[model samples]
Target: MKIAVIGAGSWGTALSTVLADNNHDVVLWTRREEQAREINEERSNYKYLPGFTVPESIRATDSFAECVENTHVILLVVPTKAIRETVQRLLPFIGEDTTLIHASKGIEPGTSKRISEMIEEELGDKKVQSIVVLSGPSHAEEVCKRKPTTVTVSSETEEAAERVQELFMNEQFRVYTNHDLIGVEIGGALKNIIALGIGMNDGLGYGDNAKAALMTRGLAEIARLGVKLGANPLTFKGLSGLGDLIVTCTSQHSRNWRAGFKLGTGYELEDVLEEMGMVVEGVRTTKAVHELAKRLQVDMPITEALYDVLFNGKKPPEAAKQLMGRVRKNEEELASLFLGTGDSDRS
Candidate 1:
C-alpha cells in the first residue's frame, strides 16, 4: 500500500519507518523543502530523529499534492494547533476513498475539539472510508530503534480498525484494535496534561509519593472529563490512558514532561518552549482541558492548577500547595469523583 505521512516530526518519521519496514511505499511530508532534500539525500532526518537512518524506501516530499496523491492511507501527525490548517490544505489532494489515521494527541484550544472532530470538519466534501486513531505509550526515540512497542488503533467501524491494525503490526511493533474511538482519543490527549503536571512535580524537588499521588488523582480527573465527553470509563486503564501517562510523565524522551520539568525549575513557559526546539503539546492541552472542564462542570483540579501555572502566572510551588490544600474527601467521595456519580462536593 502507498501511505502518506503528513508531518515529518519525530513520531511521523518513526511511523514512516515502521511502514517502510512493512515494505509499503511511504511518502513523508514536511513543510521545509530542505528537510525533504535531506531525507532523500542523506537518508537521515537529523532534526527529528538524529543518528537514525531512514529507510531507503521511505521518501520525503514537500508537495502536499504529491504526498496525498494515489495514497491508500493518510496519517496526520502534525501538532494540535496545526491540525485545522494542515487538513484544510490537504483536503484538495485527499481522495474520496482514502483512509484517514491520526497519531497526534491533543485537544484543540478554545474550541476544545478532538483531532478527529477537527478532521471531519475540515474534510469538507471529501468522504473517507474510515478515520482511525493510533496511539499508545510508545515513544518515537524507542520506536525508531525498532524497540518492542505496543499501541492501540480505534475507529467507528470494526473492519476499518482491523485494517489499520494489520497495516502497522509486526514483531517489533504490536497493534491492538478497539471500537471506542472516544475513549482512545480522550486517553491519548489528556494523558499529556497529567504528564506535564507530574513533570512540574519532579521539577519542584518533590518525591515519588507526590508524583504517585498526582498520577492517581490526575487519572481520576482525566476519566471524569472523559466520561462526561461520552468515553468509556474503563478505557482510562488501557494502554492509551494509563500507559501513555506513565511513559510521558517518567521518560526524558517526552517533550511535554521536559517542558514541565523546565517550568518546574523556575523557567517561564515561553523560555521553556523556546528552548525545547519542538512542540510541547501539554502546554496547549492544559489550556484546552482546563476550559473543557469548566464548560462541562467536571472537577479537574490538576488541570486547573496546571492552567494557572502555565497561563495565569501561578507559581509552581504555590500551585502545588493549592492542590494539596483542597478539601479532603472520604472514600465515598473519591469514588464519586472517579466514577462520575455527581455526589461529591462541587465546591
Candidate 2:
C-alpha cells in the first residue's frame, strides 16, 4: 500500500521507517524543503532522530499534494495545534477511498474536541472513509530504532481499526485493536497531564513515595474524567493509560516530562520550552484539560494544579502543596467526586 505520513517529526519519521521496512511505498511530508532534501539525499533527520538513518525506500516530499496523491493511507502525525490547518491543506487531495489515521495526542483548546472530532469537522465524513487513532506508550526515538513496541489502534468502525492494525503490526512492532474510540483517545491524550505533574514532583526533590502517590491519584482523576466523557473506565489500565503515564513520567525521552523537569528546577515555562526546542504537549494539554474539567464539572486536581503552574504563575511548590492539602475522602467518595454517585451517572 502507498502510505503518506504527514509531519516529518520524530514520531512521523519513525513510523515512516517502519512502513518502508515493511516494503510499502511510504512518502513522508515535511514543512521544510531542507529537511526533505536531507531525508532524500542524506537519509537522516538529525534534528529529530539523531544518528539514525532513514530507509532508502521511504521518499520525502515538501509538497502536501505530492504526499497524499495516490496514497492508500494518510497518517496524520502533526502536533495537535497544527491538525486543523494541516487537515485543511490536505482536504483538496484527500479522497473518499483514503483511510485517515491520526497518531497525534491532545485535545483542542477552547473547543476541547478530540483529534478525530477536529478531522471530521474539517474533512467531513464523506471526504474520508475511515478514521483511526494509533496511540500508546511508544516514544518516537525508541520506535525509530526498531525497539520492541506495542500500541493500540481504535475507531468506531471495527473494520477500520483492524485494517490499521494489519498495516503496522510486525514482530518488533505490535498493534492491538479497540473499538472504544473515546477511551483510547482520552487515555492517550490526558496521560501527558499526569506525566507533567510527575516531572514537577521529581524536579521539586520529592521522593518516590510522593511521586507514586501522585501517579496513583492521577490515574483516578484520569479514569474519572474519561468515564464522565463516555469512555470505558477499564481503558485507563491499558497501554494508552497507565502504561503511557508510567513511560512518559519516568522516561527522559518524554518531551513533556523534560519540560516539566526544567520548570520544576527553577526555570520559567517559556525558558524551559525555548531550551527544549520541541513542543511540550503537556503544557497545551494541561490548558485544555483544565478548561474541560471545569466545564464538565469533573474533579482533576492534578490537571488543575499543573494548569496554574504553567499558565497562572503558580510555583510548582505551591501547586504541590495545593494538591496535598485537598479535602480528604475514602476511595468511594473520591470516585463519586469524579463520577457522580447516582444511577444516572453509571453510564
Candidate 3:
C-alpha cells in the first residue's frame, strides 16, 4: 500500500519507517523544505529523530499533492494545534476515496474538538468516508527502535479500522480495533494534563505514594469528563487512557513528563518550555480540561488543583495541600457529573 505521513516529527517519521519496513511505498511530507531535503537526501532527520536513518523506501517530499495523490492510507501526525491548518491545506489533495488515519493527540482548547473533527471540517461530506484514530502508550523513542508496543485504531467504520489494523500491526507493534471514536479520542487527550501534574509532583519531591494517588485520581477525572462527552468509561482503562497516563507520567522519553519534571524542579514555564524544544501537549491540554470541567460542572478536584498550579500561581506543594484539605466526598459520587453534562450514569 502507498502511505502518506504528514508531519516530519518523531512520531510521523517513526510511523513512516514502520510502513517502509513492511515494504509499503511511503512518502513523508514535511512543511519545511530543508527537513524534506534532509529526509530525501541525507536519509536522516538529525533534528527530529536523531540516530535514526530514513529507510530508502520511505521517501520524503515537500509537495502535499504528490504525497497524497495516490496514497492508500494517510497518517495525520501533526501537532493538535496544527491539525486545522494542515487538514485545510490537504483538502484539495485528498482523493475522494482516501482513508485517513489520524495519530495526532489533542483536544482543541475552547471548542473541545478532536483532530477528527478538524478533518471532517475540511473534507465536509465527501464520498470518501474512512476515518480512524491510532493512539496508545507507545512513545516515538521506543517505537522508532521497533521495541514492542501496542496501540489501538478506532473508527465508527469497522471495516476501515480493521484495514488499518492489518496495515501497521506487526510482531513488535500490536494493534487493537474499536468502534468508540469519542472514547479513544478523549482518553488520548486528557492523559497529558495528568502527566503535567505528575511532573509537578515529582518536582515537589513527592514519593511514589503521592504519584500513585495523583494517577488514580487523574484517571477518575479523565473518565468523568469522557463519560460526559458521550464516551465509554471503559475506554479510560484501555491502552489510550490509563496506559498512556502511566507512560507519560513515568517515562523519561515523554516530553510532557520531562516538561513537568522541569517545572517541578522550580523552572518557570517559559524557561521550561523553551528548553524542552518540543510541543508539550499536556500544558495546552491542561488549560482546555480546566475549562471543560467548568463547562461540564464535573468535580475534577485534581484538574482544578493542577490548573491552579499551572495558571493561578499556586505552588506545587501548596496545591497538594489544597487537594488534601478539600471537603472529601464519596469516591463514587456521580452527582457532580450529572449536574451539568446530563449524563445518566451513576458514580
Tens-digit lDDT track of model 2 for 97-165: 879999999999999999999999988655777889999999988888889999999998999999999
lDDT of 3: 0.83
Question: Higher-TM-score candidate among 1 and 2?
Answer: 1
- Top TM-score model: 1
Q: For candidate 1, lDDT tens digit of each residue in 76-174?
A: 999989988988887776675889999999999889999999999988778888899999999999999999999999999999999999999999999
Model 3 TM-score, all chains together: 0.93
Ten residues in sequence with the least summed lDDT for candidate 2: 338-347
Q: Which whole-number lDDT from 0 to 100 does residue 288 have in model 3?
A: 83
lDDT of 2 at 3: 94
Best by lDDT: 1
Number of colliding residue pairs in model 3: 1
Q: Name the runs in model 3 displaced over 4 angstroms.
A: 333-347
RMSD in angstroms between candidate 2 and the native structure over all alpha carbons: 2.3
Could you give candidate 3's per-residue lDDT for residues 62-154 as a string of tens digits? 999888887657889998899888877767767667888999888888987777887787777664668899998988878888999999999
